[model samples]
Target: MRMGGLTVWFWALASASALLLGPVVSSSSTTWVADGTVLELDDSNFESAISSLDLVLVDFHAPWCGHCKRLAPQLDAAAPMLAALKNPIVIAKVNADKYSSLRDKYGVDGFPTLKLFIHGVPQDYKGPRNADLLVRYLKKFAAPDVTVLDSDSAVADFVEAAGTFFPIYIGFGLEESVVSKLALKYKRKAWFSVVKDVSEDVMMLYDFDKVPALVSLHPSYNEQHVFYGPFEEEFLEDFIKQSLLPLAMPINYDTLKSLDDDERKLVLTIVEDEDDEKSKNLIKILKSAASANRDLIFGYVGLKQWEDFADTFGANKKTKLPKMVVWDRTEEYFRVNGSETIGEEDQASQVSQFLEGYKEGRTIKERVGGSLSLTSFISSFLGLGTVYVLVFVVATIILVRKATEEEPLRVGRGDEVDRATSSISEAESREAGEKED
Candidate 1:
């Protein structure tokens, strides 16, 4: 133990500490592996609990992971608060060592993997592990309490007031009607208000024609979108859920920046002509995809308005039209659909594949377009042209020098040419004299 220069006592103390703070499992009733408000889960009950509870947060952990031991108490403290919400949630913990298949099924690659199971669908939890944050995050799934505003002026003031929640639904009818029921159903996602026997002016102010009408007002845009209805529960529920999101929100400077800041992938549909059939279809296609992907942010940019913004992402009307892309901030990657044209089925499939690939570190990134791309292309062309031009000029100068230089024999040199001419004249004179003789 003391063979090295330093001591080895830290190991013994750490071992003892782990043993002291470790999970306790007993034959009779000593302690469940997960203590306090958390429920101890096994393979048998894991699926049943998730399917039974409308909202259940599952913690996949092992006894040896240091983070799990630390998170145990935090989750235990947050459990009661979660259960106290309108749509209560159960906090369950599974010992991954005992239930290997369950852990693998849920893709628990790391220690203390937290997954929020909503109606039996599992989604990875990315929020902080602290008790307060866990409590608040889980409580958002529960139906929010409805608040009633007094007087017409009060309604106006309240509607005009600034808040984080958007499209605050104000019901102008009785509390016991279908509106309250709808409010209760969707309260977790949206804010709700009830005005007891409100006036016609109030309804008209919010763009509602009759009593029991539902008015959704957006304070940021200072405009109201009205929904007068059959008021059936199904219709109202569907309307609230879908109406909460604008089908294809235009991606502008603020929205593009926001997309970069967001944790999830931003699926932007760049459509040039908003009135074109292709553009119109994108709204529905994107809406369906958004419905399937509630975790990811969905947006669209018009080719006319936000063309510059789209250009940054390498999408323009001429080359890549009506396409879909997922910008992964974490990986710094971009994946476009394989098909050139955007089809509803193809977009959904490609997006699904991108999401799946992203988890496994398989997303491939390409260059984002700007002046840089054009500069690179021009540089490449000029670089090749410079090489060829240099070769041509060098070859021409070499040929010209070879043709104009003095010859070695009596050909082009000044003295050699004069001597050759004189020798020819003398030979000709001697031949003429001999003929005369």
Candidate 2:
């Protein structure tokens, strides 16, 4: 049975190749046709062959399709195997560009549309043009039942009926970040009715340091939210509500800012030993909490391989190791010794209490008063103004003194004539007076 099945399969493939290659042209005693040959189908012989065949496999192809080029050789190899089939199928070719009418008639939009026709009736086929897939489709449905439609028109028709609710979520590689899991969870909840490839575009847009970047788009609006680590279920639920639904609580940061009497709370905690596992875990939890909620400002000073990370938190030789500080824009401050073992829950609770009391007091800087001290500012301004005034006064005095200095006069022809005339007049007067005497 297996041998018989193999024989049938081989025969089917050969038939497919012969039909796919081109129409067979007969020459002599053995009736040699152009089987297993990739050739052109022109207007001259097309019509008569279409009239003769019960099943005509017309490949509407272009030279540019890589898949079509690949399909050509495979079609050639299958030609001889096809000759053994009881009811033989013939291969034909149509260059869609040259035969524009044929393409227009079939409504062919994309290249290499394979159409199987029987008795001039069209039926069912859609594709990526894989030969094996095509063979299976033919075997299951038979050649006559499959119809070919124009790629563009067929896509348009399907899209119209495809339905609403398109949701697209984009994320980074799962191995790179924990955010990938959150992104996938969101994708499943939203429904895969609509999906898009946003990998390249999102990576550039966000200047994303890391991913999984989750972006969801609906008919009404689009939402993008980013997560870096393990996200709590409740927090994620709230995020979706805030992002998608209009009636949702504003995220925690907004609520903190709205308080009329908000104080900047600062807390400091010190850990004695740097190499302790408890200290590292506490730091991790604190950082995670700070990342998730901006309610309390958290800073860490570590002394475990402390030299390596010392530069990161601005810690130096003078500063003590295993120190944690909580600072609110600067009204209230608290310090704790880090030589102790403090769990994540304890740290969270302590920080939360500190902020609550701190905000109630409102000892922090107000917008107007926080800029600078009035006395210092005035003194600084006056000092600069005094320096400028002295500079101007010195420049003016020098300019006046320079202007008052004597300047040498140039001897011109007019001055010479005046001097000479006065001298002559005096001499004449003296001579006249002497004569009168």
Give the number of the best model, judged by lDDT.
1
lDDT of 1 by residue, 1-437 (tens): 11110111111112112011223333332333323367778886776566555566889876755667889999888877765554567788999745877865775534577888876788666556889777755554544456677789878766654243455787777464656776666654566777776877886667767777777765544445566776778877756665565544666533343333235566666778766776767676676666566666678777787565566566665655776666553323365334334654556565455556545665457665643232222222222222223344443454355543322111111222243233333334445666678
Worst 10 residues of 2 by lDDT: 245-254
Instruction: Name the lDDT value of residue 297 in candidate 2.
Output: 40
Q: Write the per-residue lDDT of candidate 2 for residues 56-173, one digit (tens) a residue.
A: 5677765545545677765554433333233445555687646766765665533456676653344323322444444432332222111122333442342332222222333343
Poorly placed runs, candidate 1 (over 4 Å)? 1-36, 44-55, 62-77, 83-88, 105-112, 117-130, 144-168, 174-196, 199-210, 217-224, 230-242, 246-437
lDDT values, one for every candidate: 0.57, 0.39
Best by TM-score: 1
Flag regions of model 2 displaced more than 4 Å. Answer: 1-39, 140-437
Report lDDT (Cα) of residue 44, candidate 1. 69
